[model samples]
Target: CLEPGTLPEPQLVASFLDLNAPVLARACLLLECAFFVNRCNRGEWPSWMKMNLPLPMQQAEHLTQASSQHIAISISGPAGANSDPID
Candidate 1:
């Protein structure tokens, strides 16, 4: 189960705000990490290795959220700036 009420970091939030991008949100879905584990679990491997997601689903989700949020903000914000966001 995912933790409740755990918001994303402020820097990330600020970036989202600046871009008014809400595609930044994610579905909280987690896939398996076993593929990486299987590749690096050999005893001959070094111990200091680190793991990273082969594909970042969160980033994609965030961008989508950010775009949506940006559009919403543009519509709701003042009507003077050069806005091209889709409503």
Candidate 2:
């Protein structure tokens, strides 16, 4: 269920609606205001209601470096071509 004052105003609503969440199933969502209100009152919002909701999360540089290292290794090949790009 959504807490009181949880949902932002219509302008903020426009922002979320503009997001690209097509990978997250969309058909299941319906614009039923009464149902949403009742579910919020009863604390019964579906788990995925908030799934994929946007928030700031930091990216890890270590993973980036590691993947780059692997690519370097693969591109080096048996001859160890360190100067070559991933061609």
Candidate 3:
């Protein structure tokens, strides 16, 4: 998790932000790193998602509740940006 007062660099490379570049936001690291998902083509997702999780299905409901509080997030896009994300 990102602690207060420790933000990343101020400027970003224009090219890197060209398309709907992926943005890493609200990263929360669970103490127990027992779960992870792989990134693959859209075609492969259906089968991959069907795989059972390490934990029981009944407790999976808790996975989505990553945060108990919310904060304002403001992102200003470039003046003239065009392009779509690769993935």
Candidate 4:
């Protein structure tokens, strides 16, 4: 189990997500909500604001595109939110 406030390594996070998407999705939703609330209270917006969390549709697309034998992870905002997929 992950210790509090200690993020898993990037590769481990990807592996975990691939193994259990629904659990990761629920955890992500909660974490995103907490992060947003904290950021709002502090009045700080990072340069890549919307890219912080991929929306449900984006996640679905990524899952479909990646092979079952391999997991490719990318974080991007919704198409309508940004001109470039990475931005």
Candidate 1, residue 30: CA error in Å?
35
Instruction: Please report the TM-score between candidate 4 and the true structure.
Output: 0.26
TM-score of each: 0.27, 0.23, 0.15, 0.26
Predicted structure with the largest TM-score when compared to the true one? 1
lDDT of 1 by residue, 1-87 (tens): 323322344575446545633442422211112333344555323233333342478789989999999999888766646677788
Worst 10 residues of 3 by lDDT: 25-34
Candidate 1: C-alpha lDDT: 0.48
Question: Candidate 3: where are CA atoms >4 Å away?
Answer: 13-19, 22-87
Candidate 4 local lDDT, 1-87, one digit each (tens)? 643333445576557555646876758745855675677567665545546768999898888777542532223334346674654
Which is the better candidate, 1 or 3, if ranked by lDDT? 1
Pick by lDDT: which candidate is best? Answer: 4
Worst 10 residues of 1 by lDDT: 26-35
- Of the pair 1 and 4, which is ahead by TM-score? 1
Q: Write the per-residue lDDT of candidate 3 for residues 8-77, one digit (tens) a residue.
A: 3334322334546445412222211112222223233334345643556546655544332221112224
Q: After superposition, which runs of candidate 1 have C-alpha atoms over 4 Å from their true positions? A: 1-55, 78-87
List the candidate 2 regions with Cα displacement exceeding 4 Å. 1-59, 78-87
